[model samples]
Target: MTRRTVRIAMNGVTGRMGYRQHLVRSILAIREQGGLDLGDGEVVWPEPVLVGRRAHALEELAERHGLTEWSTDLDAVLADDSVEIYFDAQVTSARVEAIKKAIAAGKHVYTEKPTATDVEGALDLARLARDAGIKHGVVQDKIFLPGLRKLKRLIDGGFFGEILSVRGEFGYWVFEGDWQAAQRPSWNYRAEDGGGIVVDMFPHWEYVLHELFGQVTSVTAHVRTHVPQRWDEQGKPYEATADDAAYGIFELAGGAVAQINSSWTVRVNRDELVEFQVDGTHGSAVAGLRNCRVQHRSSTPKPVWNPDLPVTESFRDQWQEIPDNQEFDNGFKAQWELFLRHVVQGAPYTWDLLAGARGVQLAELGLKSSAEGRRFDIPELTL
Candidate 1:
């Protein structure tokens, strides 16, 4: 078998999402599986060099993972010819510049999105990547989610015939850290630090909506900062300038309205931390992060309202569970595999920098709509 090693520079993997999702669950998992099979007696293995600021932490991580290389010298790593891909999972405020540096250094670039804080920066990055003639991609892990995959399958089989509306509820209570420790980092609440629910979550929504349903034609939003202040890592109280919660109404290309609620101040009362309930003429489906349940028009329950009387019908049990017909990998890993295949075999890779820019555009417009107190039309991005 022809085995090829693709050297990659992994940046900011010390962070939670970067470490858990991108590094440990994805690239390392791929390495453990003997790399990616090309189906022609060839395999492409990934060789990653961990790059972060803290040398001691990086050394610890590298030694624990049995990684041979770790570096704080990003410029030196980027200058190396052996490194083919530059992957960034840094704070959003730090991403665009690092990505630009990678592109300029003649490396293929892949990064977490929203690629930039604003629409202009995102688009500019897309244009620069295009001009550099390097392959670029943004993380859209939701599309590869097993639950969403099943929903896509149903949509493909015409199960969701004439889809009417989609309602997505995504969020959980993020403790203020007054008593119990907060689950999320405090940086997530600061606007200057590239934090906010609208910026963080809307990117995922944009890709999910664009890939599964349709393009977002317009958006109306109401945003708020429920907790104005929160304690930081050093136990210092700080002001949170960003919106902690965002309620949005989106008009899709095909006349479907999507209502999405994202917040850190709310408690979840659903089967999953995040769930999307889709309604269509022929059938309806509710998909969580890992499971999907559907109710066909023919098998849908008929229940009459009886608020005064005791409940008789089990409404929750009416939906049929979608079976796992095949083995599914971690969502982030799945997308990484696709991207690797695209890099190695010239496979179809459409989730480019432009797609990422659209996500940032949506977030920007949503914030603008919230500020202006009116709906804003989202014209199709041209780059």
Candidate 2:
């Protein structure tokens, strides 16, 4: 077997998502599995060069993971001829410039989304990557999740005669850093720092709804900063300049409506941190991060509207659980594998920089809709 190494310059491994999901779960896990097999006597191994702002953190992470290469100077790492790919999990504000540098260096690029703070920036990146002839992609991990995969199966099998609507609830109470340490970084609450629920989660909703359902033709949103004063990582009080919650309604191309609520102030009473209930003419399904349940119209029980009487029906028990018929890998890791295959084998991959630009465009439009108190029609994007 021919074993080939593809060196990847991974920027911003010190962050939470960067460290836990991208580095440990995805890249490192792939390495542990003895590289990805491209078949035909060829195997592609990932050689990650940790790149970040803090030398100590990068060094510590590299040492902890038994990785040999670590560099604080991104320029130096990018200059390395062996580094074939550049992956970014940096803060949203820092991502654009870093990715630009990577593309200019003639490296294939992949990164976490919203690819840029605004639509124009995201489109610029897409154009740059296309013109440079470098393959690029964005992390659309949700589509690979087990629960959503089940939902997709149902959709493909024509279980839903006519999909009508989708409702999504995502979020948990992020503790004020004063009483308990905030689970999210402090920058997530600052607008100037490119932090907000709309900026953070709308891109996710856009991709999820678009991929599984239809194109988002229009959007109407209401956004708010539910928690005004919160403490930072340093335990210092700071005004939360960004909206922590967003209520949005997206109109899909095929007339399906998606209503999603993203909030950091809400308490979880559901099965998962995030869940989507999709209702159709023939059936309905509720999918969370790991579980999916469905109910067919034929099996649905009819209950009389009795506001004056106590409810006796077990509403939750009516749904049937979808069995996991096959083994499921971590969503992030699965996408990573796909991206790696696309890079190594010249496989057809649709989730490119242009797809990433659409996500950013959705987020940007969501914010605009909220601010102007009106719905905005989405414009088609091209690179």
Top-scoring candidate (lDDT): 2
| C-alpha lDDT of all candidate models, in order | 0.93, 0.94
lDDT of 2 by residue, 58-166 (tens): 8889889899999989999999989999999999999999999999999999999989999999999999999999999999999999999999999999998899999
- Residues 89-161 of candidate 1 have per-residue lDDT tens digits of 9999999889999999999988998899999999999999999999989999998888999999999999989
What C-alpha root-mean-square deviation, in Å, does candidate 1 show against the real structure?
Answer: 0.9
Lowest lDDT sum, 10 consecutive residues, model 2, at 35-44
Each candidate structure's TM-score, on Cα atoms with residue i matched to residue i, is 0.99, 0.99
Output the lDDT of residue 381, model 2.
99
